[model samples]
Target chain A: MQIAKVRGTVVSTHKTRSLTGTKLLLLQFMDAQGQPLPKYEVAGDLVGAGVNEWVLVSRGSAARIDDGMEHRPLDALVVGIIDTVTVENNRLYSKKDAERG
Target chain B: MQIAKVRGTVVSTHKTRSLTGTKLLLLQFMDAQGQPLPKYEVAGDLVGAGVNEWVLVSRGSAARIDDGMEHRPLDALVVGIIDTVTVENNRLYSKKDAERG
Candidate 1:
């Protein structure tokens, strides 16, 4: 799993029929210090994550687990919402901090 | 599918038993112009692709199709090797070029 920040939403009505009800969000992968990487991808929203929220993204085949996406040709998926992230016992990011300002 | 170039190989002898016989190769994603993206991943090799070969990577659940990975937790499988890539009549990459130099 990689840490990512939800950047935007994707509203696609002309996609394949199997992808009809899936929620797609634009994501920016973040480093441990909460900085965005240059790579960005569109991922399925499985946890109701809103824009600007920090999330854990599961890539590749792991992203297609049991979501009616078995045949939908989806790749990246938002799997969890991160409340806090710490590295080497050092505070890096916290949802409370994002909520405050 | 995305274009990726195999950079190296991974020799993991202590991994899960399900992955015992699977070949894992390190890959770097490539941009349309044949430059490498800043991303690298280890993917299962099904087509016997050697190092430095430009391959077409099918990501997400699509990566786990067949090859007896249904019961195993594996992601990022190499599905195909690219013969050539042409965009707007421009030859972006070719196996012949990679074989030349």
Candidate 2:
């Protein structure tokens, strides 16, 4: 999983039946220090993550294997919402600090 | 794209209608040198990538927008197959070197 910020949401009205109730969000991958990484990617929303929310994004088939989400057309999902983050060895990073730096 | 090895394959028969022709693979995220990262994650297959092939996986909504794929249940997809990787600033990492280290 990678730390990311919900940048926006994607709305698809006409989609597969299995995707009827799924949510798609634009996620910007962040480094350990909370800085947006060079890569631009997004994740489908499963946990109701909204814009600006810090989330843990999972990619690939595992992203679809979330509990009760088997065999869905999902490739990425917001698997978890981060409440707090703690990094050892002085590696602690935060979105706030990242914005300032 | 991150350097990764195709670990395995996922077979799902009962699936959404839009996903009828899509392929799913088991992917393990790898670091610069091709070693699996600490996180255990997998990406769905889209580029006809096979097991043991190095691929470039995309996550989230972008994973859904590949060429003819739209509004499917895909969250992660192999968008590209890597031929070679070169990192600057002495940061060039490969799967072979990562395995050795």
Which candidate comes out best when scored by DockQ?
A: 1
Q: Write the per-residue lDDT of candidate 1 for residues A12-99, one digit (tens) a residue.
A: 3333344558776667789877887876666778789987899998877676676476765467788899999998998799899999
lDDT of 2: 0.62
- Decoy 2 TM-score against native: 0.47
Q: Which stretches of candidate 1 lie over 4 Å from their true place?
A: B1-101
Worst 10 residues of 1 chain B by lDDT: B83-92
Residue B68 local lDDT, model 2: 52
Q: B1-101 in candidate 2: lDDT tens per residue? A: 34456778777789888878777777777654335765544566655666766665666664665455676777667655554444322333333454466
* Residue A59 of model 1, lDDT score: 75
| Model 1: CAPRI class | incorrect
TM-score of 1: 0.53
Worst 10 residues of 2 chain A by lDDT: A9-18
Worst 10 residues of 2 chain B by lDDT: B86-95
Segments of candidate 2 deviating more than 4 angstroms = A89-101, B1-101
**Complex DockQ per candidate:** 0.09, 0.05
Report lDDT (Cα) of residue B66, candidate 2.
49
